[model samples]
Target: MTSDAGPILVTGTAGFIGFHTAVKLLDRGLEVIGVDNVNDYYDPNLKEARLARLGERQGHQFHRIDIADGAALNAVFTQSRPRRVIHLAAQAGVRYSLVNPHAYVQANLVGFANILECCRHHGVEHLVYASTSSVYGANTNMPFSVRQNADHPLTLYAASKRANELMAHSYSHLFGLPTTGLRFFTVYGPWGRPDMMMYIFTKAILDGREIELFNHGEMLRDFTYVDDIVEGVVRSCDVVATPDPQWRSDVPTPGTSKAPYRLYNIGNNKAEPLMRVVELLEQRLGRKAKTIMKPMQMGDVPATCADVDDLTRQTGFQPATPLEVGVARFVDWYRSYHQVA
Candidate 1:
């Protein structure tokens, strides 16, 4: 982004990653105008808690708006006239998409359209949006790389995010909008979404309830820490994407195009077995969790490990936190937040 660009506009500020990224930016004393509807996709109280944290920070301005409503979103752009946008707001969840497909359509698809147009017409310097590792669906390749084909998505959620990349590419091609899309692996830490594995497993273990161990302990994930993810995000925002001069349509790489568009994976670069995550939690909380063995559900992958070579190569950054340490920090926060002994 240009040095003279206006205050950063970040959507989904009430959400997990959004909240963390916003706080980090604010801590740096950067002007940020956050947008979120605060819809109850999960527990509204959790969303409220995240927002409360952001509220405590200076240079953090907020708007209660939904990106799905084009008029409201457009109004925000007209008012804030932000030059750099971190478009993180979207219907996020793999299994939930199967149940409520329309939410994905409205938030992920339609909402992204509004953001693209805003960036195009508003003379936005750069647009960085969230993509997902789930886009690497059905590809059995260990340590998924950005250079690989991701045409087959097991869930609508992943499909929508992949579409966001395509849509952003078109805008970059047409309007010269520098766009960077980061495909994040299983992100976790304090202030994580309750629906994700980290929070669910931790909560169940504490409650003495049976945690659903999907794929019968065979699943693998590159569970990234939230702080590390935020570091990558902040760096990506500062460095606007530029067109790859070497990119050739004759044998094009999907990760980059002739336009100012780029894709990189932000992950731990380490895939841990699902059982290992449980084991670490058991050690942290000092409690045994009864496991309900279950087959892999639809829209789910057997394993995911991100090859962050390009992420490091292009951005000069990496996720350095170890899973055991991150999980321990989370357990500490969880116990404090919920007042668990």
Candidate 2:
């Protein structure tokens, strides 16, 4: 039953994007080997529910393994022998990194090293991993482009993800590994994390609680829907990156490389104001939100937008989910999931 794609390994299968990507892969008649530690970063119940959904699929076999545990991770690679890898596991949360710096080191750094080694030893065809928009750091430019520098990372979380990109590039350069890194914008949808603004604001409005507005509702985010993100992930796996003969050190670009490494931003391409998102949620839920405006917290940028021209040109796809439609769907799922009125 092995197709040309082969069995793909997806880390963090219990997480939002990982689970959605795994399901999409399974639907395409490909085998998936899923791994997740299932820690209590947010709510374990939601993670469990996501896992359960994946369990319903036939071509999936899940392992409760942390990527930071190199021995356990290597065992999975030896056993599954996945032909391609979509590495999504990491300690997530930008603000939380302020208090928990070590978590990023263990998960993002150590886990990433383990993944690269596994892919290297296992002879994987293509490796795709998740990068974040936060890597843009202090760049105030509209529609953050991969061609721009991302050396300034405000938080440990962003720094760790940036390091992952560097590490992948090194592996690609040294070992001839075909790798693609996706810088995902603010991804939100049904089964979203409780810590994300979309879920937090929706819950606060439904409960008549005050939701914190950072930067006094002036901040902007290109909130890419989960399904759109999943599409990007799958397409990236299909389009294996190749060495760019046009790459030259005389005039360099961050998007392509001399080696088989590529980076693309996966985002909505629309920078919607934070306040607009809140208003849309209010309209969808038929409830008013009690607001508490506050200045921007540490390790956070003012806005982020993705320049997806390269992504469309390469994969013939770009995230096009409308904000209102996506928000309405999220509200519906939130109401049904939480049994809200």
Candidate 3:
């Protein structure tokens, strides 16, 4: 599905995945209209840095607006007239959701509704949005698959994302909008979010601060690299979703429907122990982390693995970055970005 009609609208372009996804799109000679609030969710400086990089690209145009503001977002849609919308803007973080539940409501739920309306009205070719592995909350099933039951979300963050999947299905059914929801798992690499496990461990290890190992470091994560994630996002964006003829109302699956809606998991597909990640960081940084064991916090999962079979079958791509290589890249970026000798 080619969209030569207008630029691709990518929300949250200043974010880790969005930044990389925009670069990939621009590299493919596509005109991209990037949108982001650049909120102080973490460090605005880092967000600015990512935006600056995107701004350097010739085919890229940026708008500093929050997706929660329906009017502002709609204006961008009016002016840009994007054929495809990559909606990645949302209040991200499971633990933070516990503290600021309203942020999740405003950004994930309300903001998503606004996005859906814009896409529906603007005649978007395909709307690819970020979902999360967190939606597989409280499910002890190994290698989480999109076809499984994901109704039991453990936090507002997870619930909000799960809601996005359902909300997208409605648009696909009602408005004939093609929507694809990507469930990303433990994404980390250069320009990664500071709130994520990779950044936290690297910073604590470098500063010689005690890093708390939740679940006594027994947690397992898919730990996908940022580049691998970008590949999935871009590939998925190019493929417009179609209604599944195999979909049955009686024996329905969450991944596909009779509507033009689909869900896929983007992850390394191999779960690695959390401590193994720490060991890799220690090896790369040449410093042993000052670690303290802690019980798993509420709304936190002990393990996450992705079944990327659907994503692979659809896009002919699967996340293959090894944890060691990915950790090394992140550590290198952290050292340079923080100006740590």
Candidate 4:
């Protein structure tokens, strides 16, 4: 079925990646049912603004509901009967997890359980959920691949995300619910989270404030742009996960399964050094950022790169955004939207 004909349910519509994905789906003539709790994670106003933009579109329907509420989630599922579900809502952030661990359990665990239940009951064609590269926790693999082992998660946040992958796999095996888990790497762009690196770095630089250079600017990140991530997401939604005939229990691939479940990484194939990103920002904004070099914090990895070849081969999805071009566009958007100099 094409996007234009049926409705697709997208969770966390107010969030960065969710907002971009919903916008792209709606633009493709899809009827989008968007949901978000509008929690004060960063700024609820930004979330509200994102909702406003979605509301302006003709085929979009929004509900300010918490996914953790099972009854509420079921009610919406019964009413909408969405053909596909994109589960993006979660208690997001690595640093914040250190302070508010309960938030991660409630939103990421409980909310995700609710979404899986709804999808299972509704007989959704595909259930595409967000997993994080943070799940690669403590793995120093040069380019993180779905085929690699990811058992040693560092933070509670990573653990929770890893839990999501397992949860999806369970549902896929038991209920035959097609599930695809996306391990996203350092997504950033316009209308991005104010707490994210790009927004924080750009804001601090513009305001003549010092930007914290974690790991002494020696970190490397895939830094996938929001648009590229959204494209990969939409294409994945179109291709339902299938059980691998070659998947033997004796030797299993971490990416695929004998059940109707799969995992893929959406990231820039090219990794950019942390310092290089700062340099780009400096050049784009014509402002010199006061830098503060610091050792790596706990629950933080020094680098993350994604091997997205599986995604390309399976769904014909490839992230094509160049770092310089994407960064420049983000800078332009930040200035225009925030009225920054």
Q: How many residue pairs clash in each candidate?
A: 0, 0, 0, 0
Error of 1 at 247 (Å): 0.3
Alpha-carbon runs more than 4 Å astray in model 4: 1-5
Write down the lDDT of every candidate, Cα atoms only.
0.92, 0.92, 0.92, 0.92
Model 4: ten consecutive residues of lowest lDDT = 1-10
Better of 1 and 4 by lDDT: 4
Write down the worst ten-residue block by lDDT for model 1.
1-10
Better of 1 and 4 by TM-score: 4
For candidate 3, lDDT tens digit of each residue in 54-170? 989998999999888999999999999998999998999999999999999999999999999999998888999999999999998988999899999999999999999999999
Which residue pairs of candidate 1 clash?
Answer: none
lDDT of 2 at 126: 93
Q: lDDT tens digits, residues 256-306, model 4?
A: 999999999999987889988899999999988899999999999888899
lDDT of 4 at 82: 95
Write candidate 1's Cα lDDT for 51-166 as tens digits: 89888887788999999999898898999989799988999999999999999999999999999998888988999999999999899987899899999998999999999999
Candidate 4 collision pairs? none
All candidates: CA RMSD in angstroms? Answer: 1.2, 1.2, 1.0, 0.9
Which runs in model 3 stand beyond 4 Å of their true positions?
Answer: 1-5
